[model samples]
Target: MAVRISKILLVASIGALLLLIALDNVFDYNTNYEIVSHVMSMDEVPRDSVISWRSITNPTLHKLLYGFIIFTEFAAAALCLAGAGKLWRERRAEAVRFNAAKNIAVAGLALGLGLYLFGFLGVGGEWFQMWRSATYNMQQAAFRFIGSIGLVLLFVHQRDD
Candidate 1:
């Protein structure tokens, strides 16, 4: 029962974190949007003759991509919150039932991990060379998100049985 409650707290905490992030992104739109814009545009990266084609300079496209990211963050948060609620409600159930209640939270964490690892690290970092930009680099932040969420994900995945 203690373990179940702890798991609920961890999952809910992640959900709250993601919700805050999405809220921050929306409320402080220009700040994070600028970061995303710079990463996508590769404006801060040193000109590499071979990699010039990877840059996306279109403002409309940048806005679209940023919107998509914000939407994803919201979705992950909602799913995680819902999952946490489910887990809490089922905390006193049998072990198998409690274990079964973890699916949504896992999906939420997986979405977050995917966003940080694949979206930021793979697409932004590798494809757009975001790491080369001292002003716009997001690799470190992305890694932190990935690592933290991943750890929570692993912990939540533990079987109550």
Candidate 2:
């Protein structure tokens, strides 16, 4: 039962993290939007090199990207919160039944992993060269986010046998 409780707590903590993330993005919309905007526009690239062509000059694209990010965060938060509830309800059930309740949490974790790893680290950091700007560099933060939730995802994925 200790293991079950641990699993439930871990999953709930992740859900809380996701909830905070989503709320931050939604409530403080412009703050992160500015980050996304600068990263995408590459305005602080610090040099007049031809690499500037890679920057997005359109304002519409900036809002679109930011909106997409917020939407993804909200989805992950909803899934994680719902998953935590499901896990809590099944915490006292048999091993197979408890394990079955992990599906939603798995989906939530995968969504978050994709957002941080693929979206921020992959596209924004590498493709957009967001790491070059001291003002807008979020690669480290994104990596940390991925790592923390990823460990929980792995832990929660283990069979309850």
Candidate 3:
């Protein structure tokens, strides 16, 4: 197996991880949730309704979600670095190990976030929200796509070079 393919995959994975981190940095859920809640209440609640902190930020839930998103992003960052180093060192064989880990990680990210977006959050009915959802899904799918590439490279590495 050759390290060339792994090097390419490592670059792609790093790009994807950086993209995800950038996205997380740019978007703030406190604003998004409030906006959504406002929209949902538009057809029902009166214009005089009061907007409170509870409607904006659920402390406990946010705590849990904050930890989850941050940890996942952090793991992604670490994996990206590890993959890059493995590729730089031309560890085609060991890159296979990183790829396997990446495949699982991306699969989990896609499944978890996809479920949270469609099933739990129920986003996408209008233009802004739709764009946001698109960005979110695209970023997530990027991770999974890179993971698939990693897996393929791993299989390639498993072969005789």
Candidate with the greatest TM-score versus the true structure:
1
Question: What would the per-residue lDDT of candidate 2 be over residues 28-139, giving only the tens digit for each residue?
Answer: 9889989999999888885586677788978899998888888888888788878888988998899999999999988988898899999999889977889889889999
Pairs of colliding residues, candidate 1? none
Clashing pairs in 2: none
Pairwise TM-score winner, candidates 1 and 3: 1
Clashes of 2: 0
| Alpha-carbon runs more than 4 Å astray in model 1 | none
Model 3 lDDT, residue 130, Cα: 25
Q: Pairing residues by index, what is the TM-score of model 3?
A: 0.39
Clashing pairs in 3: 1-161
Give the distance in Å from residue 42's predicted Cα in candidate 2 to where it truly belongs. 1.2
**Cα-based TM-score, every candidate:** 0.97, 0.93, 0.39
By TM-score rank, best first, the candidates go 1, 2, 3
- The worst-scoring run of ten residues by lDDT in candidate 1 lies at 44-53
Better of 1 and 3 by lDDT: 1
Q: Could you give candidate 3's per-residue lDDT for residues 1-161 as a string of tens digits?
A: 44555544654464475456536644765643443444332323333545221232345654554455455555555555555554445544554554554443344334434433443344322312322332232335444644554554454334333
Q: Which wins on lDDT, candidate 2 or candidate 3? A: 2
